[model samples]
Target: MSMSRTWPVWARTMVSRGIYSRPRTSQERLRRAVEGKTVLITGASQGIGRATASRLAAAGAQVVLTARNESNLRELEEEIRAAGGEAAAYPVDLSQPELIDEMVDKVLAKHAKVDILVNNAGHSIRRSIDLCYDRYHDFHRMTAVNYLGPVKLTLRLLPVMRAAGAGKIVNVSTFAIRTPPFPRWGGYHASKAAFDVWLRAIGPEIRADGVRICSVYMGMVDTAMTAHTPSLHRLPTLTVADAAGIVCDGAAGNRRALGPWWCAPLEAGSVFVGRPLDAVFSRLYQRSSDTDAARRAIL
Candidate 1:
């Protein structure tokens, strides 16, 4: 499939360079797309969400930032305002179903319509099934934040988007959903996979209505969240700004899906060599766990 046919060459180039290059050229085109538009970003308190909010606001967009951290959100909003950018801070916990409804109401009331929606808020838990056998709450909490929250929010905002005749929905996803499942990521992967499938299934139906859906399968990003995993530090990771830039580019370009170039090849390999790949990962994980256990015993 030719990506160029689906998205403009500039859009694809912008996304690719945002990931691979570091020149930080002026994204004036993206800024024009964002200028005077209203964008709502979830998880805007810190990390990628905060970074994305800053990027869009700098481009002249009126940014609505939402997160559980009221103080941080205020700080960010003030910073943007001080820089001559339009911004508003709304704090909401996505995990609460009732809060989702209230948030949608408040956002629509204030902006009248949301031109771009960035679903960047999500929770991830890492634990083996053996360790989670007695912890069913893991599935519940992860699903609430990672799956239910975004879906409900999108559904609520759809009527407004349709009435306006154009909208962009950018889902922030992880590459793990495309690769073979990992051993200790059951809850996290399952929730992410659910949303990925749901978005793909509904994408076509909404496209004709001038609603563009872009799914971004990103790789490991260097953030406070990933800092907890020491093993991830050894691997190459994109900075928060880079990750946010890729997302901002996708939203501005209206691409179908924005992912690393290798995402398709990896997905194909997983489909054709499922069992073999699974076997390889199983052995690798077993060896790593054994080494870790031994080191812990010595300590």
Candidate 2:
């Protein structure tokens, strides 16, 4: 019998029905896997990072929270401490390159070594290359934060993790990278795809040194990041807690990549029929935008 069946009927039913989508591992096993480990999470001031910090902290991990918002980070730290969980906050603005080296130095000086690293920080832009023709800085800014920032941080931490003999790195990535190329996301897609490819390239090299890399190709989640999109407002999406749980599962398990179950078939389809899919999506988005513009003109 599958291990999932060993759970009570209600729990198994929930899993089968896709309501409670946690990994089949028991709670105690999850706790034991994370207990006493030092985990550094980026973008922890809000959204997925905040939720992840809370979950891992409750699992007995020593959580180091890093983000740009000092006040929010401190509030999260206080809440975690009140709940009897260990946590620390380090405010960082990832878009600044010079500060990254200094920040890494400061973090190493304090923690010495981090058992797990979660790269949850990112930036997104949704303007077409045509619209961005004069906005070169937008491309540079997003690329710096989404691609270069994580690279610098990971490169610095690699030595510490190698010395410790065992380490895990979890990258929160977007599912759009695998989808048929959509319009108006050149900057966002390119930056995120660069980091994803870079990590995959170094993954084999790091594995021999007792470091594991896991990339979570995430779908739409109900977070502040997606809050302003009218189309996404009413759409069903993963909760922050659910997204964090998936990240924790990657850290605790041997899986190299985790994503929504349906993502696999869609990704496979894109590989074989990408050209047609791209054409279709292009028409769909362009048509909607044109209709909206026409309606505005009529009004």
Candidate 3:
């Protein structure tokens, strides 16, 4: 069967256009997209994960927030409750892949079905490969959290999502991947990139089952993760809350695709419109890097 290229591309463009427009008043955009639904968000103790959890709960989602730090997750739960939002805290170590089965069982036992699974948990260390050396476990550790952890968790949820017959999977990806040899991000980039490819490939096969996967390729968003990067690379960054809003918008829209506008220029000439904008981003990134290095050496 011949496919309709325009629908998906147009859908993505329209979604991005809407997410950028008059911008829904927080309350308006948020509404009951969450009502009667349950959501699980990882890395929810802080940053983008926290931002997503707070909004989903406020929008009436019975949100399950998870992170490695139980105390911190509890504190966030209190904050969400104080704001009159529904939330529950779960503490789990994503580094331990074996635990996903148990975690999924626990969430199902309590919530019945997780309507939205935001694979937002991840780790990033701003160090070059040289700094990592024989500490190869560091690579596995980061990949475990930023990639495999989410992939495994997502797979575990598939049965529930398929049974429920409608669901959304949001994978947070980086604009940094546009540039290869992303400065000092060897582990984080490679890991996230691998997961991103895997998610995008399988995302379509399951769409007929009413399971939608939206991969959010974001430019830098200000958070503790970006704390040490030179301000130049981080200046245009969105606040964590702002970034989360964009992500939720995609999930709420239930659209097949959502991503940055820059991808448009880069994607227009692709042999296939849905092909990622990796090539363009890589060249632009190289130029940006040279400019940055030159600026820093003289200062």
Judged by whole-model lDDT over C-alpha atoms, candidate 2 comes out at: 0.80
What are the per-model C-alpha RMSD values against the true structure?
Answer: 7.3, 6.7, 9.2
TM-scores of the candidates in the order shown: 0.88, 0.87, 0.79
lDDT of 1 by residue, 63-134 (tens): 999999999999999999999999999899988879989988898898999999999998777665666666
Name the regions of candidate 2 deviating beyond 4 angstroms: 1-26, 290-299
Best by the TM-score measure: 1
What ranking emerges by lDDT with the best candidate at the front? Answer: 1, 2, 3
lDDT per model, in order?
A: 0.81, 0.80, 0.73
Model 3 regions lying over 4 Å from their true place: 1-26, 179-181, 231-234, 267-299
- Regions of candidate 1 where Cα sits further than 4 Å from its true position: 1-26, 290-299
lDDT of 3: 0.73
TM-score-based ranking:
1, 2, 3
Kindly report which residue pairs in candidate 3 clash with one another.
none
